[model samples]
Target: MVDVAQHIRIFDQKPADELVPKRTAAIKDLASKLTGPKDVDGLMKMASNLVAAAKFDKKLPEELAQEATASIKKQSPAFVREGRDLELSTIALLAMLGAIDGGTKQGIIERLNFLSAGVWLGLSFQQPNKESRIEALRVEVLHAARDYVARGAENARERKAPALGAPLKPENTNLGEVVSNLRASVERLNRNAVVDREEIDFLWWSVTKWSSALDGLYDEASAYSAAIAFGLDGGARLRRMPLDVHKHLVLRRIRAAEPVSLAGLIAAVGDDRLRILTKIPDASTARTNPEIFPVMSSLLSGSAPKSASKDLQSVEAWTVRALLEATALGLINQHEV
Candidate 1:
């Protein structure tokens, strides 16, 4: 039998203003407590207290929140040893609470980092021998993040919340190497290659990490690309993922290729491949119809100039091509209801 009553209880009963005068000292005390040894249950209780203190105290110093976020990340590595499933769930809940009520954009991003850490923990559980736990955590974390992190971001945006932060530019992260590594992995997979566990962990972790970053930047289309790469066909069982998530994954995956050249991109993945991979009825019609594929026609016109970074493209063009490539390689598939 299990009870989450303690999980939901108000663990910190201090008045909101109780810590105002000594917030720094209070935060230092909590941070010190975090550094000491603790079991899973103790850690959970401590985490709850940390979150409650912040939630109850609207004026909780931002320093406490930042320290809480950092502490969670530092502690995340223990998930595998301590049992990742429960650890991930608890950490996610605490992180979400902090994120939803956080007063600063940086704070929300910090919590999102914790969610990203949870995703990594789930991936780490993917061992060849432990198929059952791996699959269970995969489904659970995917849906949980979609529900808690993704929808939370969407809802915050819809409400025009100030704490969601100012609009962000894509990080200068050139995903060229990442894409190159993925292409090599696909080739190896095509040849029935048996990769070591380390490679598997690295590749999946890299994909999840980048996808989570894109999600943080609100580049849902590009991020969806990486997500599909991680999931592939069997992952289609993610019932909550939308159908339209199909097209964009392909575009962004290919766009991140090493050379980052427009001509190379076109030559590597032409319009024909795009149509076949996407299963679009008419490639030209889809491209020209701005409603369906805005900026796509211009991208395929051969006259469109490359952005300075070469990895940059209209978010509209990103959806289709990456989906196309991943589908062609048989790594990803269209979402099915």
Candidate 2:
């Protein structure tokens, strides 16, 4: 389903706080959060997601995924390469950093937490043992940078930012020709002969859903999260995930809402963030947005179909609770935007 509300680019730049002592204090607070080990579950979940991201959609072969990841690392410190395998790790890392830049202490802390978790997770999956995890972190920071590169590439492509150019420089040049070719290769590999706007919407939904909570208590995970949830501990594996589940459920609720409009839907959800999501022109602006029909049909009639609660008829609670219930049942993850 199309979300009419636009999304704030994660890379948007905001002015720095002008306070003096407060800024210094914020840095200390952020450091405390990053250097401490208080959130074990968060660390583990982050680790699993990074590993699972290295294996997203179960698409790219394992060895190749590793190589793509490595190539990315050789080029950038964060992500590996484009294509299905590195999608989640790449995007998450970029969005995390892009949003964190010289902001408040809280923002800096949040960014650091995610980054540390990402590094730990990357090591957890690549190393064969715990002892090796530390050893790898010490020895292979540069040797392994696919996840970092992947992050840069995605941010560059989505925001039309300048290229990393020749490998590691993250400034002032567009990777236009490079991004176009990479996108073409990925689509070709998918057997998607023609990637129109709808297809872009589909993949956008697929990738954006990679976000998850650090721990089960506070954060939520989705199919993208589950796909890359595998970690070095080998505790969590990618369970069977139904594609199009979230798209279907969301559209179903919207259609169920009489006199639906993008503005109204945002009003109902009450999430300010929804307003920032990039608009889906192909699916949302069309007469009746007919493109949503097929996607909606698959949801209502699919083998594991579940109906929305009568309570869900309203736009007031667009919490994606139904989807979370499915995640609880192992059908899908909590993909709330």
Candidate 3:
């Protein structure tokens, strides 16, 4: 079996100085253009051009590439906040090229999250009405679900057989069963390449109904929390995670509301589990008290505890509950957080 974590480390390793001057010059030029309001579209085109250029040159380390992306997002929040698809798509394209060059599953999942977010954001910008927005979200959700199921199938194929005369561990056995079920679900989804409104309604029902079936097999809370963070962090992974696990995180984030930064989410959860899971830097830096958006105060006050504690279970529950509430209120679904 592939060691996903090890693969990520390999991709993260800094490359030796080769064409450093050229790469630096290219990045500096890109950064200069990214600073202006009108240059957002140009940046996106440049990102795509970079991807093509990367095909012939040595790919940048994942770390360097992601750093550049973060810088761009931070400098151009207006463009990102507006749900500019072209800009996001450019970021995804660059990441995709890096992942392809590196042959890392971690890279693939990262790319998918970016692609998925860009697609969803694009849909949101185009659909001005609530009903249309919901419809668009549902369609994308189905597509993401299908892609997840396909990935599960691939994982199933790669599963190694237990050593002869040795029984599989309980966790392994349970995972095997879950993968089997997932494969079966994919078979049903395959019958119709594009899921319609009626089909999506049925899927929603099925997901809710089968929620408990995977209880011991999956940690829904952790997955949901991670997704919230990923969404807030603009589809970037704060830490290393398997593609399969990260898929759940990103999908939930895509479905949930726009997340604040990691710091903001930690404050929202009002607990330590997320801090430990994502290794968040400092709570003091996070905007716990809502300023511009009073809705955030209402949401956090209702869900998060007033006092901080070491209770991880409460944190998980609070995060999941808060996200569900946000989803209902459509706070996390739209561009604004």
For candidate 2, the 10 contiguous residues with the lowest summed lDDT are 1-10
lDDT of 2 by residue, 197-245 (tens): 3345444543343333212211143222221121100111112111244
Per-candidate TM equals: 0.22, 0.21, 0.22
Model 1 regions more than 4 Å off: 1-107, 117-130, 160-337
In model 1, state the lDDT of residue 297. 33
lDDT of each: 0.33, 0.29, 0.32
Instruction: List model 1 lDDT by residue over 78-162, tens digit each.
Output: 3122222233233333443333333232213233323322332223222222334323434443444334434433322222212
Considering summed lDDT, which 10 consecutive residues are worst modelled in model 1? 328-337
Model 3, 328: alpha-carbon shift in Å?
Answer: 22
Error of 1 at 90 (Å): 12
Report lDDT (Cα) of residue 109, candidate 3. Answer: 31
What are the per-residue Cα lDDT tens digits for candidate 3 across 1-337? 2122222222234533442333333334343432122322222233233332222233433433444555454544332323323333233333333322232222223333322222222222121224442233234433442343235334433423232233355768666766666666665454333223323443343233122212221234444344333332322212211234333443443333343533445554344242332322222111232221122332334343343223333233334333222221221122221
